[model samples]
Target: MVHPLAPLSEASAIPRVRRLSDRHIAVGERWIFSAGFNVRSDLADTGRVDVELADIARLADAGARVAVVSHQGSYRDGTARHLDFVACHLTALLGRAVRYVPGTVSDAAVRAARALRPGEVALFGNVRLHAGEEANDPRFAARLAMLGDRVAVGGFSKAHRRNASNVGVLRLLPGFAAASLLAEAERLRPWSGRDSGRYSVAVLGGTKPEKTEIGLVHLASTYDLVIPGGAVLNALLAARGHRIGASVLGGGGRRCVATAAEVMARTDRCEIHVPRRVVVAPAGAPYSPRRVVDLDDGVPPGHAVVDFLLSPWARDRLRRLAADGGRALVAGPPGMPTPAGTDSWRALGRYFSAPRVRTLLLGGDTVAELPYEGPASTGGGAALYQLAHGTVPVLDELARSAAHMSDMPA
Candidate 1:
């Protein structure tokens, strides 16, 4: 077996990364990564999966003796498949078999990682398996931090939650917390930078309105165009006094609806576009007859409108906007598109890939629905970013982690 400390002479697999002339792990050097892959079945195609794979590959290429710390799933989703899924990817990305240590980043886990041969990696079990993780207990962070000589955060999806793996361990690292090879964090870096001359657009959707920030009132005031879609559209429609029939409302519902109406009515800076047409299913049936209805037609009491009414008129206006240049933010989906997968996502994919759209972002459930190869964040990060006018605490922590690197006594 190759000695763990022997220098790796191989070049980096990632583009433009400088080669490690001598990628040697001295007595106790290891790259501890806070990875964000969850056990949810969606890991099969989500953006977090895509980005983390690249990060792991890069770290492996850098010849770092790596320890991947990941969430198996949300705290309650204690499914073995989740750990099995993440471990599979870790092994593939590292190009060598990985050892699974079923414990917190406790002393045993640390010892197991340290014992690996050069190029070997250890994937720790769900950090959330331990009680101290979610509570941000210092003892947990300290224990987890002991596993590595350095730390990097690879789980962009989990950044919003200040957990033991992502936030706690960083406090003890000597310098900046290393970033997983992140690309979009920079694109979204200037979230708070404001310019009245700049044009912006935001599209808010999804079934759970509770997940949205009423601060969207601010986005409505700031952007040039605001389109409400999915179930949120039902709220906006109701706020505008349109009949939504039996469509379930989400987020702020009546209150949020009223506020949005007032903004659309009063604000000159932003124009709110509610779909005049929508996709509705009769009686909310899985195979119910679905059709596009005019905004005034309303849903029948037993029926539900599940998708944005993408009429010829609606499609034309949206494509025009995409063809034009500006910043665009997609909040999320209201509920699943009714009648299965026909309505919502195809049009969204077109706009997401449109070249002239300039800045494109998707957050919340919307991120999962459309898996385009681009920078995106989960609903939590997206909501906070919108509320803060683009500032994300996780991203901010990543930014601040650098100061610790440069200013602290090395």
Candidate 2:
């Protein structure tokens, strides 16, 4: 009989191996564990064991050769810090030797791994280079498995994904959850209680409409939904039959609008809010105040809607809704980048800066552009967060949200 938690397809394909050592081994009992930086803002203050230098030391001292895999660029100062900490601590702890794989796992990474002795460890560079990693290819899983005897998945933030590292490899080999990964899973488990004083609100914004649609559908059922940023707002407008520019549409904008419409039709309990007023730039021109359109009027073609107009009515509504204590999630930038003197960008910043809103921000452009002078947080379905967290489950959550909303009574 197959293991209960294992997927039916995987279980049928391969019988579950009883012991860790019984599975397979290319070298002296290797244990491959995946890790990533804790990017969540709230976790920073909670005195968590974030797989720091000491953590690696402890593992090395226990005779486990450590292999660190991260997608972050070496040029980035942050990546340097993580590498420095790992290298310094591992060297100090091992006191003999260490090896580093400088680039992403490919033929090169495989070659490097093959060269390692039974007891030696090899750290592969970023795993994101292979498109199969995101697609959760079995071949990729098999390749990754070649590096270790047993797999210990510790990237909790990424556990929700069925990707190669998070799921595929687990199926192919004996799998164990890393301590930190288990802890994060446990932390989120209590969130099932509706009255846990932990209601979450997500602000969905991104350039990709499909991703935004999926993320919003998921988050909307479990938490309050706040929609911002030009792309998402435009999609909302398009769903309502407003005329967005053909240029934008051909460039992956139409698909977003279509996804939005589909989502709006599917979900009932999740409230989808669009901006009351939108700043639009005429085709091939930077946004100007003269082109701003109220949602009461239809959007014109050959124009891009840039920012949410925080009118008194909208501001009052947001402030009132946010007065109650709960978490707020913000994704994507509030507006498109405009000319330096344009009011679109400035207005977008002001909307985010408004009082009475406690926000947990996610996505790269959203965090970079918006002047959100509050406690910042990061968690989302973007490729950046996927690489950072080492998994992508935002899409799954989005699908679940849509289903939950569909089940709600009208």
Candidate 3:
């Protein structure tokens, strides 16, 4: 009888894999997976772990020898968080204690690969631990190539970064393909189905304005309506010459705001709408003395706009925008003050859950806020930026690999 996993051998059957590499090892035989699990402005990587869990199961089920490489926490952090922490997160989800090996290219690492028990995974040290991973060093890529016969680039959130693990190793692989999770994320659409032919709305809400610029422009250009929230909202309000008072403005939002203005001016179809009311506190006192006020009433100079888009009028507006929807890409939610902000999340849940809604692309922070769970990504700004632009180099190559394999004959 033919081997149950023999179909994976078809990569050689596909001409591209042969052209890319002379190696004969199947995809499941030995593989290096460069995953992206970094967070956006909110410092949440939970979604990243959740997404990768699916890939782990698939690779394990295929009886593949997998070496999972990922970056954790932020670059700005004094030190990279321990890889064991991520192991903990994955362990909870997989319901099994995963095997972890310390070195990326040590002899011991090779031994661990040799010892794989068919469905077990061996997660390598954080890719960031290796000094050359992010530099796209050819030497580092070569070292990683020593482990895997083929490469799979599935970190859609991390695809934008030209790190060695993402593209460099991909270049070395005789052939490569997309991880099932990353392939799913790459399909993110700005507007879905017949709704694209009609009016569509987008929500760009995240803590950092600088990071959200690309998404803002793309949303403004694609959707009929663009709604700003959190720091993005403050910047947009200021762009229109509204009295911002002392609201928290994300550093470097003006560049994005100016870009949005230019796009709005030229694209008469896209509209920018502001909330009639906002929740505010004394400028320096963001936590206390909070109250709601109509924008028409005017805010005091010492007051800050902590949250908005949860008032009755705001909800009604959201209801209409969300009604008969086309597609919604919510990066995150509007700023909320505890008990006050909680209602906004629930309201957002109701709005996005509308039957007319065609698509919803949610990022990490936005995913956490939703009452109803959906596929979310950890690539944060990088993920949004990738979606706005066309195919990423890493994922693009992976697609080519899959296509090539599909074209091969038995």
List TM-scores for all candidates, in order.
0.72, 0.63, 0.74
Tens-digit lDDT track for model 3 on 1-410?
11111122221121121221222333447766677656433435465656567656666667777777777554444455547666666667777667777786677876776677666676777677766777778988888777766665566666666777877776666344444333444445433222455556567666765344676766666666666777777777766667878887665657756755565567443666577777788877666868888787766788988777554555665677566454555676656445445444555667777776654555556666555555455555655665566445665555454444332211
Q: What TM-score does candidate 3 get on C-alpha atoms?
A: 0.74
Candidate 2 segments whose C-alpha is farther than 4 A from its true place: 1-29, 36-57, 72-98, 102-111, 114-121, 154-161, 179-201, 246-255, 282-291, 296-301, 337-358, 373-378, 382-410
**lDDT tens per residue, model 1, 1-410:** 11111111122111121111212334335777777766466555555555666555556655667777777544544543336566766576557787778765667877887776555677887787876777788998888887776666665556567777776776776322223324444345433333464456566776644333443566666566666776667777787787778776764567666665666677354666677777777655736667778878776677777776454655665677576645666666634554356466576557656776654455535655655566565444434343444433454554555434332221
Model 2: ten consecutive residues of lowest lDDT: 6-15
Model 2: colliding residue pairs? 201-329, 203-329, 218-398, 218-401, 332-366, 333-366
Whole-structure CA lDDT of model 3:
0.61
What shift in Å separates residue 2 of candidate 2 from its native position after superposition?
Answer: 18
Q: lDDT (CA) for every model shown?
A: 0.59, 0.49, 0.61
As for TM-score, the candidate ahead, 1 or 2, is 1
Which candidate do you rate higher for lDDT, 2 or 3?
3
Residue 100 of candidate 2: its Cα lDDT?
A: 64
Worst 10 residues of 1 by lDDT: 1-10
Q: Which candidate's TM-score is highest?
A: 3
